[model samples]
Target: MDETAHALGASRTLWELVDRRAGLTPDRPVLLQGDRTLTFGELRDGAERVAAGLYGMGVRPGSVVAWQLPTRIGTVLLSFALARLGAVQSPVIPFYRDREVGFALRESRADFFAVPGTWRGHDHTAMAERLGARGVFEAYGALPDGDPAVLPPPPADGTAVRWIYWTSGTTSDPKGVLHTDRSLIAGGSCLAHALHLTADDVGSMAFPFAHIGGPDYAVMLLLYGFPAVLFEHFAMDTALPEYRRHGVTVAGGSTAFYSMFLTEQRKVPGQRLVPTLRLLAGGGAPKPPEIYHAVVREMGVQLTHGYGMTEVPMITMGAPDDTAENLATTEGRPPAGMEIRIVDAAGRPVPAGVDGEVRLRGEAVCQGYADPAQAAGVFDSDGFLVTGDVGHLRESGHLVLTGRMKDIIIRKGENISAKEIEDLLHQHPAVADAAVVGLPDQERGERVCAVIERRPGTGDLTLATMAAFLRGEGLSVHKLPEQLEVVDALPRNAALRKVLKYKLRELYG
Candidate 1:
């Protein structure tokens, strides 16, 4: 690790780093939204006051507080206040309903629950009460406030598990992922170092602030003393003005975000999407290489994709200075202090360029799942967390992900990579987005099914045309998708905008 990163990693806790950054640049803006701006100095003072109020309300260190609020200035203040008070916070995505929200509150045993009143046409306060949540209170425009003198000293330890983040839970109930202050800081440091960001750069947060990326992105802002715009509701038409208004230099949430920007740019051929957008970078779902080449060619911006998950916020990231082939074909390289190991089925190390399960051991990795029994099977004997992802490392140290172990389609007892076919489908001119899944088949055991969202104004896409396109692209005959389904939009999760493959299987199977 570099000296700057090493220093950031040494911080005892998240609030401590906030204090350090605020001390250095008290007047600099840390967050921007429309006409509102929150400076470093205001963040410190406001959070301290809110902490005092919460303390007065009997919220102390180690208190379990669950908050489900939108991405707004008040939400950030509440989160920082919890950090200042050393409370264990579990952030629930605002879009979650009674089923997921009830599970999280019950699992975490939260003592206090914060809701957003009536937001986006949903009555969260009533829902919290309906779920029998304890200490349910609305925290929106007006947060609790009190005298700062009543607050206790901030936490000194950074290694304690103070965060509980839930997974998307596509197959089953969500798993609570345990995280610490140091781990989140380490994850953000990897992103900041790889992106080569500076104080002059402006960023945008289009995803939900309750997601893990909220803290991960905040750490970068604190370390580099730059500002990022917050979008409570992000859409292509609505969000473009905010990006241009702030002169955002770096923008993107994930693959869906890249496609959205490209679509807008196509409406006006010669015009740049965001005048100041020089780089489009993010990672959550898989990135088709075609998207990389198209963004560079049409949008005239560099696109760098990385690999990360709920367990590890950042594993690998593509650097801005890397070669074009590496940026498009590989999920950048891991930073210093992060170890990437590829192992065979028996847990033996595999040779470079050989496909195997990807495992990780690093400061950015989560401690473990909240359920001890479930955690035991996630890590190997050597302490590396089995990522459940199938990939290989290239000779250049870059990571090449094939697909998920469960996502591989079996046809005639032959395993085929769904991601491989999906990547090839993305290169088709008429195909806007694609997802591949395995469907039950008596003859082939499991057949390949392709679900695609067509580009606007495009004619109906047929299975034969898609098959011919894949064949022309040099795809293997056995790997071709036998079934095709077209739709106006692909189902996606609200947080990372990742396509929900299970939903597709349920709808088409």
Candidate 2:
């Protein structure tokens, strides 16, 4: 990495880093949506004006402000405006409804709440008023504005908790993950360094701007001085033209995104889907090894998957030059200063190649949850955060995830990994997507159920056919799926597009 990029990791505050980058590349585009371009200089000047406006409304340093906005230039300006004032900001995903949004607002005790008014046929302003939210206002078309002289100096301390990002509530209520400016910077540094990006490369943000990745990606752009295209609503047909127009070189959100791009490529065989695209990289969901090979061989683009969560946005990432085997089978290696520990049930460290709970500790890790009660049981004695994922580290320091602890299915006292079966199923020519879930059963304790979305133009797939395919792949007979259900599509969330397994269990259990 270059000296300027390395120096970004040492920035004490998010606003400071923004200022430094803007000064270096004042005229370069920092954010783009449609025809609206936000140059580095405009980003700083506009945010300060909005900060002054917020200050006029009695928002001071350390004040709490929560916003649920879509992916737009206005949203980016509002976020930076809050950072300029050093206010504690809580960003809720635009797709989250009352249940999750109410919990976040109440728990965070936000003094102000910003919404997009009417978005995607939903009236957020009405909901905010109905929920009795304090300081409810719209930030879609235009944000509050005032004189910059009214604002105080930007915050100097970076260790203070200023960000509260919520987890996706798949099985239960979400928890608010607390973060500092330094932690976000550290996480972004990991991603920027691993990708080996240059200022000339163009990126894209297809996911929600409210996600933890929003700030993580913005930090990378600030450090590397590159611009990224933002999508308000991302669809394959509509997004391709914009990507091509801007010459997007790096594009990906997660494994689902990779699959989508691959599917598009298959439509017109022997033609590159996105001609300028060279790399597909992201994290947030488990990637099947076969999917990696398909992208590299078919699309002719390098696929480098990674491992991360809301608590720590960027944990481990695959580099562009990693070995094919390592990139396919492993989630890549952690950068310098990140410590990954695989521990047994009793909290003892396991040997390399042994599957266990994944624990992480580093500058990038979140401070804790917003609710103190929820934070009590998350960290180990040595300060490592206990991640519920089950994975093992290879001797070469690469991470190999098996599955989640709660995702393991126990049938007749034998444990079965859902990810293992899902990975094998993904290799099938007829299967477009598959999720293996355990259902309650009186005879075997729990029965293995395979829910699949078949590829277009494929014939019906019965339980017998799936079982036979698994057997041919050398899967143990005991691990064979006992039930099968083919659906049009798998249920997924808005951000990261991760399959909502809990919803699948609700339907199939």
Candidate 3:
């Protein structure tokens, strides 16, 4: 989960960071790619020019411009240009397939679309051509046709619509989350503070900028006049050198990638890698206690656990200094200017000990979901966003997320949780990535089916093997997966995390 991208150095708006840096570190590199660098001044100038071009295209105040691209100078500049126009910029990550992408385009009603011509393997130009958008600006190409820009029309938080983002869905239908111009400014501030990023802190983004994590985080660092190492693609081979070359002081990515790096026991031959990095952020999936313990012991960097979604945005983040247990067990407590509650089925707040739906209320929350009726169902009577996850509160007073209320499977008359099975499966040495879903059973209402990706080069993790592993650990016969599907790699999203269970269901079930 990421808030808006604002500066932490002082009380400054997102624009103020660009303004200050364009003056202080005008020659300092603001963005970096393979042998390509854009100084702060150049970035500012390019953005203004691009904003002028966008204005020529009639992208005015409140217009929704959806951008889909891998990280690049163009992506960053165009984002700034859109912000300059007071247009709510929505970034579409690469992880989304056409189904998800088409859903967001319709729900956002985006007037202008920005994308690159080509990426490492994906074709951005083909996607742009397929969409047939009204105001299409290929960020990757040259658009010499320009005009002087005009100031945006009178500011209004007045329901003109903002960024319509899609969160990981429970059902097949993806959740369209909305955020306003004002909301982005307000929310991004939380990230700036929590990370303690400074102008000297060069951030290397591992995730795509379109998602809440990358650009939003980078935008905040940019606002602080820090150099941002923009990776066109998330290549670990490339990421390590950039970390050392750019002197990136802070770096982070999703839990899956963090696990990939840590679990592999990566070694660098030279001096200390990424010596300046102070913060390492991991989220997007449940972070097992063992993963966090390993990261702390090995990386020797502050681990920040963030909990977020496109719908609820960044709800809770476990700060580095908060405590080791908080980082391991629960998502951090509610941030400032936010309220959280554990509610039962009747929409009533339950006692702290009992597990129920997690509800949140804050400026950072989405304006609403896509459909009005659906929005009514998602938002509570008192205007709290209903997070479908179920969990209990320890006496220690931190959020302990257990499982999604919607993903819970019913077996015979008993409700069986996939999270319980998945967590137990993760403790095994062979299991790398695991997902549990209910399979139809004529006898028992539903039977548990576990789909797992084994550690690289591992053999087939059939039902018999899983059963033996579970039995050796304990005799929990009922909780075992009736079926197991072992694959090479688990499907992930733009964040290089988030198992696309919906896609898996469509592909397998």
Which candidate should be chosen as best, given lDDT against the real structure? 2
Cα RMSD for candidate 3?
11.1
Q: Model 1: what TM-score?
A: 0.81
What local lDDT does model 3 show for residue 158?
A: 28
lDDT of 3: 0.67
Q: Rate the local accuracy (lDDT) of all candidates.
A: 0.87, 0.88, 0.67
Q: Write the per-residue lDDT of candidate 1 for residues 59-97, one digit (tens) a residue.
A: 999999999999998899899999999999999988777
Worst 10 residues of 1 by lDDT: 406-415
Of 2 and 3, the candidate ranking higher by TM-score: 2
lDDT of 2 by residue, 1-509 (tens): 78989987689999999999888999999898898899999999999999999999889999999999999998999999999999999999887677568888999999999999999898999988878899888999989999999888999999999999987322335678999999999999999999999999999999888989999999999999999999998898999999998899999987668878888999988998889999999877657688889999999999998887788989999999999999999999999979999999999999999999999999999999987878887899999999888999999999998767656665543446687789889999999999999776543546899999999999999999899998777565767899999999999999999999889889987
- Model 3 regions more than 4 Å off: 1-29, 143-160, 263-271, 393-397, 408-509
Residues 437-506, model 3: lDDT tens digits: 8665433435678889899866666799888886665434555778788888878897868888777666
